[model samples]
Target chain A: MPTHRRIDVSKVGDVTVVTFLDKKILDETGIQELGAELFSLVEQDNRRSLLLDFADVDFLSSAALGKLITLDRKVKSAQGRLKMCNIKPEILEVFQITKLNKVFDIRAGEAEAIAAF
Target chain B: MTDHISAAGWQRTFELKSDRGASRAVMDVLLEQLGAHDWEPSDIFAIHLAAEEALVNAIIHGNKLDSTKKVHVDCRVSRDHVRIEITDEGQGFDPASVPDCTLEERLEAPSGRGVMLMRSFMTRIAYNAKGNSVVLEKSRAAAAG
Candidate 1:
């Protein structure tokens, strides 16, 4: 079974907001569990819109980034939109350097992200 | 040949097993200390991200997560720079051979992004001739003076 222990998934209107419960998401096991939860949302629940709230996350490894990229693709293929907000400036640099900033819909906070959807 | 150096303001080296989880744990503690020292937010990000990528590559790609293998790291944080060296105990691959992930065709590819991230964030990145060792260096934030 997929465990959502490291994350809090809630709904804000029609959008699904996932807030990371941990300070850092770097371990393989944590990434695997998170991946399972996210994929289940897309494949089974068919949740279309996603807002990843990173207010609590301090760091993310490349493996974690890979998982996010994979999840983004899955959401897109399902004709759903995925976005993230409240990313720490340091962690946000990763997305900018990788040019994923151009690929993902990024906003300043939950209110703005939800409004965009 | 120097296992210890006082030239840099801060220096530490760890001989780590090829367990990704343990390696990250060690890095976490070191990063916390660096943060406490008031390393610039940008410099901290670059160093931490580059170190994580390099360490992961050494443990997973190089050592294949083999518990028998080991990874070595040397970290030096001076007033104006953060330098890290990572070495693994496996056959190496050519760094030049990695594809350009920025290309439209390769953006979605799962692999090869780590090398790209390291190069993007670090000011200087180089691999030893054997390709088993990598060095990442980033200039620290300018002094507030």
Candidate 2:
């Protein structure tokens, strides 16, 4: 298994549950590392179902959003699934503001997100 | 480099490098001052988001991370509102020509949403004719809570 610094990886049944280690995902270097770790799950690990739990994330910038968009594309190209949950209300407003709420599968909780996968 | 405090509010000016780390440090100070002034959490979040977008745009897109270029920031926080102006030393682009990121076909594109988010969160956002300078203002009452 490759070492990861920006995310915590676990297995819930067949689904891969990834959690962010940073509360604020605004720094460029951090976002780049995060994007690499997320892309690796699909590109190297061949994880078919991925669930991103944002329970620890308090903030994110447009650059972070760009990473998620790229990750979503990578998963789709790999014929995999991606879902996100536990986004705080403030961050959810960001998704709604950018209309990204329509682009990804968002759920209310981890259980709900996992079940959907 | 200039910081002024009065009975009403505080103001500070900074000349930052065209680097993310440099900009992040400045943002931390701004957020700290906002908290000290007892700004509402939601309002702080909005200000932080807008400021982050604008700074990143100036540092990355405007200045292109040129080591020689500097990004100037002027911030004022009053009881009722906060205003920030960021100017970069680069050839500016037309803000009016920025495509709408919320459009149906453009929804999946990741790069263009920064400008839109700034406009949505700030009470008012204006860019200089040169396009390298931008002012972001948010009034407490107008903040989307």
Candidate 3:
């Protein structure tokens, strides 16, 4: 297991659960660091079946969405799965407005996401 | 660079560098003032997200993060309304020309969603002809019951 800063990594029945550590995911440098760490899960650790829980995240910019889109592509190319859960209503509105709800697998809670995966 | 409180509202102007840190600092003060004026959390979130997208567009897309170029921000927060204008020093693009990110073929693209997000969240968003300058506003009266 490698040291992580932007996300907390845990496992639930072979599925990797990742939680964001920041309330606001807007800063460019921070978003870059976050993207690298997330990509490393598939690139470095070779982990499949990832779940992103956004309970602690209160805000995110469009740049952050860009990273998630790239990560979804990576996971698909790697033949793995990616899902997200616990997104706040306002943040969920961002996904809806961008129509990203159709792109990524999103669940209402951690258990539901984990079960789906 | 100038910030003051008037009987009508709180106002501030900032000449920021083409750096994310500088922009984040400016956002902090804007958010704090929104809170001080008793804006609802949901409204605050909308303003925060919209302002951030506009700032990033001005800094990264408009100014290209040029150290020599500066991004000018003008903001006013009142009990029933909030407005912010951001302008960058660059050869601007036409806002109308930005392809819709929600298009089926363009949905997966990693970029080009900033302008769309700004338009969706704010009560009104407008760009100057040069496209280097943008104004974002939210009307609390409209949002409230």
Query: Chain B vs. true chain B: TM-score for each candidate?
Result: 0.87, 0.95, 0.96
Query: What DockQ do you compute for every candidate structure?
Result: 0.66, 0.85, 0.90
Interface RMSD of 2: 0.8
TM value for model 1? 0.90
TM-score of chain A of 3: 0.99
lDDT per residue for candidate 3 within A3-97, as digits (tens), equals 99999999999999999999999999999999999999999999989999999999998899999999999999999999999999999999999
Off by over 4 Å in 2: none
Kindly report which residue pairs in candidate 2 clash with one another. Answer: none
Candidate ranking (DockQ, best to worst): 3, 2, 1
Candidate 3 positional error at B67, Å? 0.8
**lDDT tens per residue, model 1, B85-139:** 9999999989999987767787776557788888878888999999999998877
lDDT of 2 by residue, B1-145 (tens): 7779998788999999998767876798899989988898888998999999999999999999999999999999987889999999999999989999889999888689899999988999999999999999998878644
Residue B140, candidate 2: C-alpha displacement in angstroms: 1.2
lDDT, candidate 3, B1-145, per-residue tens: 7778998999999999998767887888999999999999999998998899888888888899899999999999999899999999999889899899999999999988888988887899999998899999999886674
Candidate 3 positional error at A91, Å? 0.5
* Prediction-by-prediction clash tally: 0, 0, 1
**lDDT (10s digit) by residue, model 2, range A36-55:** 99999999899989999999
